[model samples]
Target: MKKSSFILMSMLLVFTMFVAGCGKSENNNASGETPKTETETPKESEAPKKDVSLRVFSTFGGTDTAREAFQAALDEFTSKNPNIKVENDTMSANDDGFRTKVNTDMTSGNEPDLLFYFVGADAKGFVDAGKVVPLNDILDSDSTWKSGFSPAALENVRQKDGNIYAVPLTGFYEGLFVNKKIFEDNKLELPTDWDKMKTAVQTLSKKGIIPLAAPFDQSHYVIEHFILSAAGSKGHNSGLADGIDPNWEKGYAAMKELYDLGAFPKDAATIDLGMASNYYGEGKAAMILEGSWAMGNWKDPAVLDNTTVIPFPAMPGGVGTGKDVIGGFGSGFYLSKSTFDNADKKDAAIALLKHMTSPAVIEKIALANGGTPAAAGVEIKGKTQTATEGFAMVANADSVNNPIDTMVAPETFSTLRAGVQAVVTGKKTPADVLKEAKDIEDANKK
Candidate 1:
């Protein structure tokens, strides 16, 4: 099948996205600082061997599947560069505080030497604020490192200004994970479309099994898929700058429709993502909304054996095709501006970034977490069946969209999330929620 590039990605093959490729800017001087000349340039090969400590912050800690692989990569870097010490500062991506901590540190002048975060809207603030240095020159200067990345991976991460700020390691795709065994036992069909999905939810819920294991607070995946399922790719990427799409309301309405039918866990109102995932991992939930990175976290052999992924079905009143997916090269590591200018640490930070994102390390992390490796021709080995099938799903998608959060203001996305409970419980209409979210989006642009 010919894989179409989604809003922010132009994927090459299976399990990837085709983000809209923006024209690369002609000028390379947008980043505030001037490039270092040959003599003063920091190269991994020319770094002086001396004691230097660097802190790197990311979402690679706690129960993250890539935690050990990431640390091992760092350990290898630190071992080779014995003079450099790396403080592995990390937070779980599931936590509400993850973005808050990153923003706080970036704005407070306490930015880490290396930051692993989202590539788009989330990084826009810091990137525009000049907290991080654009790596275009550095990447160009090193032919070996520059050639290691897939051209599309690098291109999709380019900021609106046409400069590449974040260096990508892996891309990702999100899907609806179905437990085949449960469906079989209940004599139900896979939720390939809205009617089938509702049937499964009603059947599973009647049998006392959670139809969909999702939390209200960290409803990232839920919101993403629902919106994509309702609005389709073009509408999903059509940020609120123009106006709210009517299909957007249908997304929320579909969520309420599922909620009224007992799709979510009873304690979903208060449980966090971890708890919701725990329910799915323990085999108490028949289905879940998660990304490829979740493959390692679901430990039950039975669950793993029965697992398969599909794009969330389009809702009844929405324009989305059931084949649309949510995914892309969403995030990567950034070299802090402060670190780049510090002569003592410049070489160390750049070297570490190079080493961490090297093709070999990218393969390892991708294997561990089921992320699509960003390095061209770097094949991931021993991926689970679910992961492999998810690749096929992405390759077959009508449109693979970036998460709605990336397209909208953070506050606007937050408002949409906040309205889920209110909408599901009959306290608010879907139109009201969309209006409130659109208002917030408009205000944020001011």
Candidate 2:
């Protein structure tokens, strides 16, 4: 009997021990403290991450080098981040229609995840509407990225309120692009002054070579250059706001003289910028007054080989000695408030933005597009002689001014554009054009 009692007690003790082990096992499972083995690893959640889609808009479209470079960078980004898909909505870089589309979209509260557009007054409405994300925080947080840009480049995109709203990609300059072969073959000296330019115009016209490939119908480039060259930086910045200055009249008189000398194509009043570019590329025109952006259009080997760029000669009694340039960081990328506000995609969007504006990307764009890189310390090598000369013009400049159209109200710019065209086509005298411009400016001021 005593032995039976001992066996039963032993069985009971064993049962208690088993129960305690089971309880401990259950508690470990419940507490998520499962014992790990030497070779075991924690399992990652099997649930797939939610895919993100981003909508991006840009003015760099069509056959432009900027478009191509942008696409290349975008492609690289997508390759690096396969989870995020980007939808590119692009339009012609030079078209005013893109601005209309963006304005419409913003008004409807359908802003894209990313946008590439002009900075400054052109973007003030969007910025004021609270559609864009102020980039100061992002830039401040990333010292590496912030250091990539020059202070002048950053200042160029700063609004009147002293806040940066965009990331500038390129700097631009305007100058006279000459066909060197044409001048050399004709035994004519390169124009270095106003009198030399006039003589070249007369000589080239007599030789049946279109002296200047000007497109008065659609482009205000030459007109802007002439005005800036005549008025200089100080006069241009101050005069345009105060109504038409007498300097503008002198600029117009010079343009009229060129027109009378048959310096422009016969169809200048009807032709667009494309036709003018074609003439310049084919060596049909001796010169074309254009911005650095136009350098990409002259891809023909002969044209590239023969091209050279120089600042327009200083006009008599003008404020500048042909050393002031119309250039700065004019265009940049703007972030969408919606994108930055989205919790799911904000990080990815910011990462993409940083990638796009990175020094490497800026250098690539500048090299491919032939413009001054907004990012500091980025040098574009292997440039054509024309591009080299363009760079020299910018490097040697004493002052740089924003284009008048960019600095003035839209209505004022429209009037100035139309008035300049009319003066160039002989439809109105310089004084008459200036009067009309001043009236427009005065009305806007009122």
- Predicted structure with the largest lDDT when compared to the true one: 1
Where does candidate 2 clash, by residue pair?
none
Candidate 2 achieves a global lDDT of 0.82
Q: Write the per-residue lDDT of candidate 2 for residues 1-446, one digit (tens) a residue.
A: 69999999999999999999989988998999976669887678787666789888987786576788888899899898888898888997656677789889987989988888877556767888899889998999999999999878999878778888889988888888888889999888888788888889999999899999987755567767888878888777774666567888888888888888888999887787778988998879999977787878776888889888888888897776788778888888888898888998898888888999999999988988888898888877526777887887788888877777666655666676676568866889888877877777677556
Output the TM-score of candidate 1: 0.88
lDDT of 2 at 435: 82
Q: Which stretches of candidate 2 lie over 4 Å from their true place?
A: 16-47, 442-446
What is the per-residue lDDT of model 1 for residues 1-446, given as tens digits with 9 covering 90 to 100?
33453622533433232222221221334645454466775546775667999999999998999999999999999888788899999999988798999999999999999999998777778888999999999999999999999998898888888899999998999999999999999999999999999999998999899999998878888888888888888888886767988887888888999999999999999999889888999999999999998878988999999999998988887889999998889999999999999999999899899999999999999998999889988976437888989989988888878888887778988988888888888999989988999899888778
How close is each model in CA RMSD to the real structure?
A: 22.4, 3.2
Q: lDDT score, residue 436, model 2?
A: 74
Which stretches of candidate 1 lie above 4 Å from their native place?
1-48
TM-scores for all candidates: the values are 0.88, 0.90
- lDDT, model 1, position 440: 90
